[model samples]
Target: MDIEDTPVLDNHMHLDPIEGQNIDAVEDFESVGGTHLLVLNKPSWHLFDPASDEATFEEVFELTIEAAADASEVLPGRAWPVLGVHPGLISQLVDEGYTAAQARDIMQAGLDVAAEYVADGPALAIKSGRPHYDVSEDVWEASNAVMRHAFDLASEVGCAVQLHTEGSEDLTEITEWAQDEGLPPEQVVKHYSGGRLAGPIKSVIAEKDELEIAAELDEPFLMETDFIDDPDRPGAVLGPKTVPRRVRWMLEEGWEDAVRRAHVETPARVYGIDTEATLGR
Candidate 1:
């Protein structure tokens, strides 16, 4: 299929209406042939005080859902929300005077709120993971507990999860956790993946080299820009156009079939959403 005919889906992206580009970024993505976006909620601290309660989390999720809804006006049924407490927020909570255990409890409560959003409709997945940075053993353990709670909530809601955590060559432990929680490992996407990780489905960054490596794997994978949508950072993780540009590049480089799998088949199967329908194929 021609690049224009192909459906380009960004598996993980964030849009901020307040301090960021908002729908303008979505317009940018659409201009470059982006067909769909999984718009995950930004961290709690980005929208409210670190010490905010569950009510604040509900507001954050509502903003995310609204952002996705607004994006659908641009792309029409191709923008979906993914809501959850950011794992790094545990650090923020601890810094705000809550103990590690208390932080875990708060994070878990936030996930509960996010899960309700998924169960009710607006969101297609939950986002959760441990801190990517180093922390005390207590905090580390607490983060893992919060992540596990996310898995449980995802299972109950029958939705996928997008994880943000330290990069690793092996994700066997994470896969096992999902399976134990009764959520299929394939439903757990490792966002910002480097490529070819051993477990949960990898949402490889849209870099050409990473996409090449992930395409070589036998397992299905998805692509993302992890676009932060910050006007100040201006393409921090990558630009809104990154995925579509990389997909076109891949097509030029003789990766048509891989592009179909990564952008269309994998996302449809993993999220249990109808990519073909959304693309009006």
Candidate 2:
């Protein structure tokens, strides 16, 4: 499998249900003649956020898993799943001022709504039999541990890890830690390099520092446009058809081919996905 043989490959994307968008990207990929598509997992419901009670982390994880399973079945080996906690969720869950009650409510609501579509679990052994609080310094460490476990689970299930390495020292540190723990650098794919705007990662692209890091570590890197329609973050949305526009910018800097090729070739090798298979000569 190779790039020339395939119609197109979308390296970074969220396939699980979001807000209320019914057109999961996997289906959309098939319609567009995309030979191979990789979908990243959002953290489970219970762990969604301490502020909202939308659903449980376990529940959302299940939904994502089911969606991956369904996409695999529907596309018959054309779609693959990249499981991990997205960074946006991590940021929300860890922000200092975010109230625990608010987090719980928001997460609960999402979890409840997704209940019918997914199951929850891999529930942690809460020491005091209570939800983890946001403000506690220990909470950040604890959440990292939980996400690390999720990463292990994803690997066990033969899925790639699609991690959002946005504006956080924690994420960068975790990536380094994962490498130390024997996870190959190629196994992790960094997404949404542009949307991030804080922490150490905030100015990665602006500084053009990440490329050196990526080359030095030999990791497969990806840049993305998070075309999310969030009323809470009204300025975040870049409309639904923003991919091409983003691609154009990447091309202007002579990065479009380099990034896309790295994304397709490297991940294909890591996940054992045959690129030629999708090309359908």
lDDT of 2 by residue, 1-281 (tens): 33233334445444435553424544544553444445445454323443334335445555555555665554523544443333334346547455444443343334233322222322110000012333354544444554454344433443334444323433455556545545554554444443332211111221234443443343344433343323344323333233333333344565644445444555465555565554443
- Compared with the true structure, what per-residue lDDT tens digits does model 1 show for residues 145-174? 999999989999898889999999798899
lDDT score, candidate 2, position 58 = 44
lDDT of 1 at 279: 79
TM-score of each model, in listed order: 0.97, 0.53
Please give the lDDT score for candidate 2. Answer: 0.41
Q: What is the Å distance of residue 198 in model 2 from its true position?
A: 16
- List where candidate 2 sits over 4 angstroms from the true fold: 1-7, 16-19, 24-35, 42-58, 66-77, 86-136, 150-159, 165-172, 194-219, 227-241, 244-260
